[model samples]
Target: MSHYYDEHDLSRFGDMGRNAPDLWDKFNDWYQATFQEGSLTGREKALIALGVAHALQCPYCIDAWSQECLEKGSNLDQMTEAVHIAAAIRGGAALVHGVQMRKRNAQLSM
Candidate 1:
């Protein structure tokens, strides 16, 4: 079966700069700087990225960040916890939005 997400396509991500070299360069610079060691260690940043990848539901980012987390010395346990944290935040956000729906329904009922 053919899948829409080709793993090989991830390798070509750098090619995104071909048509917009300046923009891509700026983004790349910012992205690289963001991941550098600062208040957080590289491993911590990788774990955070992994959590964000799950929250965003991006297969490419998930795959990349999983490897990055592992390479940066995060074990499966830590990565799993990060994923769970992302899931909890995403689930909570969805549930919190239901308050808006409830308010609208009450307004219509009145």
Candidate 2:
């Protein structure tokens, strides 16, 4: 069966640079700079990236950040917790949109 998200496609990510070299270079530089050790340690950043990867629902990012988390000394427990955090935020964000629905319903009822 053919799947939409091929794991092998992750390897071809660099090919994006071929089409837009300048833009890709800028993005690469920014991405590299964002991951550098600073106020937050590399491990902390990796955990955050993993959480965001889950939130964004990007399989490639999820896979990459999972490995990044592990390599940065994050344990399964930590990674799982990060995923849960992302889940909670995503769920809450969706639930909060109910306010808009409620307003629309009220307008229609009037």
Per-model TM values vs. the true structure: 0.93, 0.92
CA RMSD per model (angstroms):
1.6, 1.6
Q: Which residue segments of model 2 deviate by more than 4 Å?
A: none
RMSD of 2: 1.6
Residue 48, model 2: lDDT of 95
Q: Please write out the lDDT profile of model 2 over residues 4-104, one tens digit for every residue.
A: 89999999999999989999999999999999999999999999999999999999999999999999999999999999999999999999999999999
Model 1 RMSD, rounded to 1 decimal: 1.6
Q: How many residue pairs clash in each candidate at the backbone level?
A: 0, 0
lDDT of 1 by residue, 1-110 (tens): 48889888999999999999999999999999999999999999999999999999999999999999989899999999999999999999999999999999999996
Per-residue error for 42 in candidate 2, Å, reads 0.7
Name the weakest run of 10 consecutive residues (lDDT summed) in model 1. 1-10
The lDDT of model 1 is 0.96
